[model samples]
Target: MSEVDNYEIVRQKLTLGPLTTPKHRKIRRLLKIFWNEKEINLLSHFGPADEYNSLKQLQERSGLPKDEIKQILRNPLRKGTISKRGTKYCLEPIIPGIFEKYFQRSRDTEENLKKAAILYWDLFKEVLPQQDTKVDNDWSLFRPLLPLEANEKIIEINQEFDVQSQTLPYESVKNLIDKFEQFAVITCQCRLVAELSGEPCKVAPSEMGCFIAGPGSQTMIDGGIRGARLLNKDEAIEFLKETEKRGLVHNAVFDKGDQSSIFFCNCCGCHCGVLFPPKLFHERGAYQSNYSPKWDNDLCTKCETCMKKCPQKAIYHKFPVKSDSSDEQMVLREEMCIGCGVCAINCSDKAIKMVKVRDNVPPDRQKIGNKTFIEMLQ
Candidate 1:
C-alpha cells in the first residue's frame, strides 16, 4: 500500500474509542514519526480495538507466519503499544492507553521521551477546542482525590477539626487501597511528560507516583506490561502517603466513585493531562476532582503560595500596592477548583483548606459506575 493508504489504516485504528482523531495536523505528523510504513504493516495485523484473541487469529488475518509476526510484535509489546493476554494479543487505546508506552520508554530512552512530550503537547493543543464546550453529562474523567488532610500544621490554625465527613472510601487514598485486592506501582505518565518538557516534579519523584490496583492489575501484570509492579495493600498505602507528603493530588480512578479502579495517580497541577490542560483554558477537563480550595483569611499570612501552586490557576491573588502589605489576599473561584487539594497539602500558614462542595460530594454509589476504564474518556 502507498503511504496515504497506510496512514489511513492507522488513523482509523487510532480513532477508535478512547483514542480519537486528532483535530490538528501535528498529531498526524507525530504518529508518522513513531509508526513508519513497516510498523504500520505490523500494527494492521491486530485490526483495531483492544481485544484478547489468539496469535493464530492474527496470523490468519495478516497472512504472515507466526515467527515473522512474533518478531514484529515484540517491538510494540516492549514499547507498550500493545499488550498480551495469555496467548492472545491486543491493541491499546490512545489517551489512557497508548500514551503510557511513552513513559515506559522514557525510563531509558531520552530521545523517545522528548518526542513523546512534543506529541503530547500537540495533541493537547488539538483538544483545546473542547475546553469551552461542556460534556453531555457535565462530568470529568477523574474526581478530585481527597487524601488524609489532618496534618500536624492544621493545629496552628486553631480551628476545630470539622472535616469528619471528609473520611469516605473514595475520598481517602488509604481507604481506597483497602477496597482493592491486587496492587501495582508504575511511573506517573504526566510527571514523566513534565520531566521530558524540562519541568520535573518538585514534590513526588516522577518515577514512583502512579499505582494500579484490583483485578485489572492481575491481567496487565500477567501480560508483562512494563512500568508496573505488584504491591501489597500495606505497601500501596505507604506509597500513597509518601506521594501525599510530596503534595501530589490523589486521583483515584475507581469505577463510578466507589469501586477501586485499575490505577490511582498522584498527580500535580502542572504535569497531569486533565489538570494542566484544563488550567490552561481556565477550567477543569473531562473529570472534576470534586474538591475546591477555601482560603481562610483569618489564618492566611498572605504569602500567595497557593496562587503559584494551583495547576488550574483557580486561586487569584488580590493585592494593592497602596494598601498595607498584610492586606494581600488570595481569591478562589469555586467552580474552577477541581478539588485536587494541592493547595491544602502543606500550607505553611494553613490558610487554604479543601472542602467538599454541598452539591458535589460523592454519591451513595449503589452500583458500579464506570463500566469500563475508558468509558469516561470515550
Candidate 2:
C-alpha cells in the first residue's frame, strides 16, 4: 500500500497499546516527525504494542529480505521508536514510547524537539481532561513507594493483619533499590518535556531523573543511550535520598507487588507525566501507597511544614472559627493524597507519621490494576 496507509496502520497498532495515540491531526504530525516513510512502512509489518515479532516473522509478513528489514529497523531501534527483545521487535505506544524516546535524547535537532514538545503537551491537556470526569474509577500504571523512613515503627498496621507476618517488600524506596544490583540514572522525561515546553520543574533538576534497575537494565545502559549513566548501589540510595529531601515522591511500576519493580522515578507533581494530568484536573491518577500521614494534633504546632512539603497539595490548614481561640489544625484531604509520605518525612515537629491505611497488593506482571496491562493503557 501507500505511505499514508502505512502511517494509518502504525497508528492503529499504537492505539492498541496501554497508552493511546488518538487519531488527531497533531498525532499524524507527531507520527511523521518520529518516523520517516520507510520506517512507518516497516512498522506496519509489526503487531500491536504488546506483541513482538521475530525478524523471520517480519521478513515473511513484509515480503522483504532479512537485510532490508534490519536496515529499516536500525534507526527506529536506536531512536527507541521500537521495542526489542533478542531477535524480536515490537511497536510502542506514543506517549510512553515515541514521545519519551524523542525528547529524552540530546541528539535530536532543537527545532524538531520544540515541535514534539508542543504537540505532546497540547495532546496531554486536551485528552487527559476527558479522563478527569472518570477519575473516581481510574487505574494507574505507576504507584507510590513510601519513603524508606516510613518503616513499621512510623507506620501503624491494621489490627486484623498480623504485624509480624506483614512484610511489605518493594513498598519503600530502599527495599526496591535493594532488589536489584545494577542501576542506571537518566534525565526525567517528564521534566525534560516541561523544560522544552518552558515550564521547568521547581522541585528538582531534570537530571535528578528516574532509576532503572533490575535485569537487562544494565545491558540497556551499556548500550550508551544519550543522557544516561551508571550508578552503584550506594550512589543509587544516595540519589533517592536526595530526591526525597527535595520533597519529591518515589513512584514506580511494581507489577509484582512486593516481588518486582520494573522502574521507578523521583517525581515532582509540577511536571511529572504520571502526576501532572491528575493534578491539572483535580483527579486521582496514581495508586496510593498503603500508608497515609496521621497527624498528632498536640505535637503539630501548626508550623505548616508538612503542608508545604506535600506534593499533592493534599494538606491544608483548617482555621478555627473567629469566635474560638483554638489553633488552626492541619487537615488532610485523604482522597487527594497518594500516601507518598512526603509530608510525614518532611515534618520537623514529628507531628506527621505514616499510618497503614489500605493493604491491596499491586496487580501481577502484565497487568495494571484490574485490567490486563495492555487493556489498561488502551
Candidate 3:
C-alpha cells in the first residue's frame, strides 16, 4: 500500500463531531476516489473542523515546498475536504460543513456540480442507515433550529436567561441573526442536492437560504466556501422573513459546540439535511429546537396542511371517536415535536403556537455553558 492509501486516517480525522464511527468507511473510500495520493495527505494535514493550520504549518508538516503545498491545497479545498479561514485551512464539518461547501463555489461546470452533489447525497445515505431510532439518547449531527415565535404568539420565555447576551444566539431568532457582526446567505445545501438529484424541492426554491455569520462569515466569503451576501441587520431580518413566509424552519447548528453561530438556516422537511434524515429514519428525538408546538383546537379546522409540511412527523390528527359532533383536531406529539413552527405558521386557522418546552433552561447559555438543550432531546 502506498502512503496516501491511508485516506481513512484523513477521513476519520475530518470531523470534530461525536459521530466518529465505522459507518463512514464506505464514504471515506468514495471521497478518496475523488483525490490522488498527495491530495489525501494534504487532506490529512487537517484534523477536526476546528483544527485549522496556516500554509506554513502544513508545509512544515508535509516536508513539501511551500508552493507545492499551496497548489496541493487547492484540489481538496475544491473537493470540500479542507476549508480556508482567511489564509488558514481546516477540515470542514461533515454535516452542514461539507454539504454547504460545494454551493459556496462561485462557479462550476453544471456537470461537475452535479457529480459532486450526487457524491454528497450518497455519502449521506451511508450515514443515515448507521443511525437507528431505537437507540436511546439518539440525536442528529445537526438539530432543528426553531426560530423565535412572534412576540404575541410566544406563550412563555425562559425566565432565568437572556439570549440577547453576546455569547448566545438561541434566545430567539431575533437574537440569532441580529447579533452577528458579519452575515452571508447562500443556497440551502440540502435543497440543492435534492434538485440536482432530480427529486426537486417540494417546499421552497433552492436559493440563498443558508447563512454564515460573525468573523467566520468573512472567512467563508474570502475562501469561497459560502457565497457571501454581506447583509446588514435589516437585510438579514428581511431575508429570514422570506423563509418564514415560505413556512421553512430556521435552525441553528452546533458542531463540537461552536454555537457562536448567530448563523441560521431556513430548512424544509423535504430538503434540509438537519430536518430530513432524522424524520426519514424515524429518528424523531434526534434533534430539536428549544421549544415545542402548542395547538388550540378551538381554531383548528382539521387542516392536514401542517401535517404535510411537518418534517419530524410530530403532528397527527386526533379524532373524538365517540363524539356525536364528529370533530377531528390536529395535535402534536410533545415527545417528538421540535417546535420548528411549520404547522403553526402555515395553519390557516392559526390554531398552533410555539411554546417553551424547557422553560427553565435558557438557550443563550447553552452556547457557552451547558449542553442542556441537546441533553433535553436525549
Q: Which of the numbered candidates is closest to the native, going by highest TM-score?
A: 2
Please give each candidate's TM-score: 0.74, 0.86, 0.75
lDDT per residue for candidate 2 within 1-378, as digits (tens), equals 643588888888885424666777888888887789888888888988778799889889889999999998888776667767778887777866565665555456688777787777777677655543323323456778877666733565667667863447757776756677777887887887777888777888788887777754565466555467777778877887788879888887745542246467788977777777777677656777777789889888888888887888898998887666365699999878988888887777888777776677765663522234322211
364 Cα displacement, candidate 3 (Å): 6.6
Cα lDDT over the full model 2: 0.72
In candidate 3, stretches whose alpha carbon ends up further than 4 angstroms from where it belongs are 1-4, 21-29, 44-63, 78-80, 84-89, 106-109, 132-149, 154-169, 176-184, 212-238, 254-261, 360-378
- In TM-score terms, candidate 2 sits at 0.86
Over the stretch 1-378, how does candidate 3's per-residue lDDT look in tens digits?
665455677666644444442436556654655567878767666655556688788888778888898888787666554567678877654544554554656255577667767766665555654554332332343445544445445334454446442123443566555566557777677778777877778668777577656675666557665345577767777777777767787766444244524455777766666556566666553345556677677777886888877767777877777656456677677666676766776667777766655532322333212122222111
Write down the worst ten-residue block by lDDT for model 2: 369-378
How far does residue 378 in candidate 2 sit from its true spot (Å)?
20
Candidates' lDDT values, in order? 0.61, 0.72, 0.60
- After TM-score superposition, the amount by which residue 215's alpha carbon in candidate 3 deviates from its true location, in angstroms, is 7.3
Better of 1 and 3 by TM-score: 3
